[model samples]
Every structure is written in structure tokens, then in C-alpha cells.
Target: MSDRPATSRVLVIVPAWNEEESIGDTVTEIRACVPWADLLVVDDGSSDGTRGAAENAGATVCQLPFNLGVGGAMRTGYRYALRHGYDVAVQIDADGQHDPRSLLSLLEPLGESDIVIGARFASKDDPYKVRGPRRWAMVLLATVLSRMAGTRLTDVTSGYRVCNRRAITVFAAHYPAEYLGDTVESLVIANRAGCTVTQVPVTMRPRAGGRASHSPVRAAIYLFRAFVALSLALVRKWPAQFEDPVAP
Candidate 1:
């Protein structure tokens, strides 16, 4: 594993939709924590003033034409990072569950891997927990993905992730835009395209603002959705394997 410097040109991309409540503070915290990195908030056609809030908090906001979900927003971010000549790209939720302070540690493994996942449950000490079917779905996904990538990945659903230039190139062109596509399917795409993956344990916190999107009560439905996501990811045909066309 090559050791990457803490000073690599970094772009922190935050995909947001109607996150005006938390966008400002999230931007502020990222700037305060990773001051050396550039911040971009891809506002996914929010009906609120998310763009203005992010700009006021000192982040460059990229407004989408319509709501394309987190997957589409991040695809834009990948393209932006590739075009602007950034060495690293990191994606964190705009809701603030992903702590900005963990970002540096998340990027540490990039020298040796194409992707570094800021996993929420890699360590036994991590207190973050999902109960019932949600937990089962996540565990099932992790077990299968770990085997596929030849590495133990505990939290495949977590959105906090860091990617190097090579992974960015692959994602810029072929990142999925479907539901659950950003985290689960994206990893499969990266692995299939010959990218290496690793993880660092991190604890998740309560959202700084906005509402939580998860509800464990819908057990059966959630489990079925998870299965469908994984099945679709496995059966989909990738036209041509990504081979880092851009010089790194």
C-alpha cells in the first residue's frame, strides 16, 4: 500500500435534497475540519433554499435540473472532480450523520486502495446499530460484498467514502443512479472495474438537521428491497470494464 499525503488535492462532495435545515452547518463543519479540501454541495433539485444556504456557508453548490437522488448527484460530483484534476474525492451525506472529522482518516488508505469506506460497523466498539430486518439486510450485503471484493467490508450501505483518481474515473462514467445504487451497486462496479477497496471503522451520529430516512418497522419490505438491489447489481451487464482511461 502506497502512503498518500494528507495534502492530496481533495474534493468533498455532499449530495443533498431539501436539506436546507442542515446544509449550512454541514458545510461549515466540513470547511472547519477539512479546510484544505474543496467542498461542493450538489443540491438535487430541492424545493427549498439549499443552494443559498450551502453557498452562504462557503461551499460551492451544484444545482441539478431535477431530483435524481443521491446517486445522480454523486455522479455529477465524480465528473466534476475528474474535470478539475482532483486527486481524491469523498462523498458524505448532507444530513450530517457522517462526521467531517473522520474524513482524513477515511482518505488514509487510498494510497493502497482505490476506495476507502468509512464504515459504521467495522469495529466491535462502534455503537451504531440497526435492528431486525434492516440489520439483517445490511449484514447480508456486507458478507456478500466482502467476498466479492476479497476484503471484509462491514458497512456497505454507509455513504461516507473516499475514492482516488482511478476510482473516480470509473464512477464518473458508470456510477449507478438507481435506489441503493450509490453505496451497494457502486462498490460492485468499482470492484469489477479492477479497483481495490478497504475500510476504517467510524461511529455515526444523529443528524444535525432534517429527518432521519430509516425506519426499522418495515421489516419485510426493507429486506425485499435489499434483496432486489443486490440481485439487480449482480445480474446487470457492464458493457465494457472500466480501465482508467484518464492518466493519473
Candidate 2:
């Protein structure tokens, strides 16, 4: 067994959508990696047996009323974490791409920093087809957004991340629901709130089952819409009155 952090109160929130093939394996692997973590699987109205599989794998399941996409499901988990008073909450994708063993690296920055995101390209294992023009555009967009937000955030599209109690509270209250661009939006919100954001390298692979939800056409449209929404957020100062030390 790997050594776990003593001060870290970690909860693994997995958002699932027809990931019956991988949910059980993913949960079991996460348990093996961080036995101390409280695993919660948010079933995003999957037609498959993802919910049951996750429960059987010893993970606490939260079935969403509807398919709220990744961001909404993640916020549901975040609300639970806040209500339960967890010190840290980490988001993991339902697909097998995100390595469970890398939980330690993700949480290390959370000890002192407010939020830590996993940088996928730090050790890229994604297929070139998956990493081609789409991800390239995402990285460029993230870089521009980071500069505007006064931070140098990498991997703004990554699903793996760890957040402290303060960040959890902030997100649980006002997470975006329209699109699946939580990474960049969350990073921007945290940065504007004066939260210290950091990144750690992580290894990721392709999904185990089901096709990717975002097609190339959908991705391009999402990118333009996301950019507009984020721009509006920046101009409006939407996530208002966030200070360094949010009350516990």
C-alpha cells in the first residue's frame, strides 16, 4: 500500500455517464491507491449499470435527478463534501484515463495551495488523434484565459483536480451548468477569489467504454461559447467578494 497524507481529508468524486465498463475498476483502483479517501460516484443518469457497479465497488453513490453533465454532477459531489466538512475534495473522471495512483501528487499542492489541477500533457499518454487540433486549441485558449486572470494555469481542460474546503464551498454554491468547461471556469473563479492554484503532472489514457461525448464539431462550438461566457464573467466580476482565507 502507498503512504497517504495525514492532514489531507480527501473525497474522490467520480462523474459517470454510461461508464459501466470502467466505473467498478476505476473505483477499486482508487480505493487501493488512497484507502483513506471517501469515494463518491455521481451517476449522471447513465442507461448502463454504472451506478450499481460503483456501489458494488464500495463507493458511495449519488444519483443525479437528470444528466447534468460533468460540471453539474461534480458540483453535486462538491456540495456533499462541503456539507460533510471534508478538508479536500478531488474530482476524477469515470473513464479509466485518469490514474488512481496519482491522487497523492494531486493532493500535495492542496496542503498549502487552495486548488491543484492535474496537467495531463506533463506526461502525455493521450493518442495523437485525441490530442490533435482540438486539445491544441484548448491549450491556447487556457493560456490566454490564465493571462487575463493573472495566473499561469496549465491543463484547463483536465478532469483531475484537488480542492480544499474553501474551494469546495465556493464551487458548490455557484458552479456553471450550461457547458462542460468547468476546468477553466473553476480555475478562473478560484484565481479571482485569491486562491493559490498549482499543477502537478498526471498520466492519462483513452476512455475504456462509450464514445467521447464531445465530437470535433461540438468541441469547436463549445470552445467559442465557453470563451464568450468566460469573457463575460471576467468583465462582470461574477464570482464576487472572494478573499484568500475563506471561512471554514
Candidate 3:
């Protein structure tokens, strides 16, 4: 690798749980789309062969000893990215939803923004009747939080995203663990820390394999918990002190 600026290095993190059906293909497809990116699959206590499949597909694998949920696995990935000195870190789900080709579009905003969320509303593939309610709820909550926190955001629960070194440093240090809306904890924390955040539309597909962990009941519980947690977090001022793991 050339001794280039940190901004040029990108690492893609996929936090997977029992996704043996899609992990290998996801890694292969991502490598095909962004060959320069270093792919890391954080296997969140998968009993299946997800780790083997990802490794055979040529991605660097980090298998967590226990199931840490999405937020925990993602934070682990951020730590890996920071330790490895990656200039950028991107999160893509292992369930075949996040389009690998759209990674570049997500990463593009890093030139101006510290973090970029791949908004699904921009895609024509979204069925409004189904996604509309979820979108509305997220937008409503995000707007309230943004106004309260003195920040702006488009998609608060988006899983597809890219973050530059500035973001990796911040997240690796103080990322909230639970009750954070599907990845909304990071968005809120980033905003609180004054990190530039932007949203880009990305086409996401239904998982080709395995059932989603979130059912209607689970989603409701998650939403209620997230709202309460964010309300508390929004009121506090996050100090801007974070350690850069890769600093010499």
C-alpha cells in the first residue's frame, strides 16, 4: 500500500449473525464492486459457517465471542478500522439488503461530511405503503432530536453508511450500546459531537435469506426504548474528547 493520506483508505464492516446464507456472497459482491476496500465481517456469535464463508470469500473476519447486537458489533468494527488506520469506515448489513455498488455514493460525502447515511427513500424500489410509516416515524423523531440538539439529519435509522477518520475516532470511544434506534445512536452522538452528517439515497433489497430478527413486536419495543434513550441522550452535551486509536 502506498503511503497516501488516511482519507483514501476505506474499510467496509459487515456485522452478521447467523447469516451463513448471505455472508459469502455479500463479501464477494462487495469486493467486486469496491476492490480497493478492506472488507471486515464482524460475526456476531454466529453458530453457522458465516465466518468461514466470509474468510473464504476473501474478507478479513472478526468473530465476536458473543452476540453483541448491531450496535455492539458495529462499534467493534469501528475499533478495528481505527486500529488498522483505515481512513474511512463503511457499514453494510450481511443480509443482502445494502447494495455494494452504492458504497461509492455513500463514501462520496466524506469529502465534505464526517458521516453519510444512505437514505432508502431515494430508491424507486421502496413500496411507499410499507416504508412510509417507518420513514415518517424516523423523520419525525429525528427532526425533534435535531432541533433539540441543534443539528440536522435525514435518515436516523439507516444501516448503510460511511464515516471518515473523525467519525471513527469519536464512535470508537463513546458509542452508546442499547435502546438506540437502528443505528440512530451513532447519528445522534455524531451530531452532538459536531460531526458533519449527510444522507444519500441508496437502493436496498429484502434479505435473500434468513428471517429478520425484528418482528412487529420487537420493533415496537425497540422504538419505545429508543425514543426514551435518545430523549435522555439529546439533553446532554457530549464532550468532544475522543482518542484516535491509530495515532502514533
Highest lDDT among the candidates is held by which one? Answer: 1
lDDT of 2 at 24: 92
Q: Write the per-residue lDDT of candidate 1 for residues 41-69, one digit (tens) a residue.
A: 99999999999999999999999989999
lDDT, candidate 3, equals 0.78
Per-model TM-score versus the true fold: 0.94, 0.87, 0.87
> Global lDDT of each model?
0.89, 0.78, 0.78
Lowest summed lDDT window (length 10), candidate 1: 239-248
TM-score of 1: 0.94
Give the root-mean-square deviation of each candidate in angstroms: 2.9, 3.0, 3.4
Q: Give each model's clash number.
A: 0, 0, 0
Q: Identify the runs in model 1 with alpha carbons over 4 angstroms from their true place.
A: 1-7, 243-248
Candidate 3 error regions (>4 Å)? 1-7, 122-125, 128-136, 145-152, 213-216, 245-248
The residue pairs that clash in candidate 2, if any, are: none
Tens digits of lDDT, candidate 3, 60-117: 9999998888888988998898888888999999989888887777776788889888
Give the lDDT of residue 136 in candidate 2. Answer: 62
Ranking by lDDT: 1, 3, 2
Candidate number that wins on TM-score, 1 or 3? 1
Check candidate 3 and list the clashing pairs: none
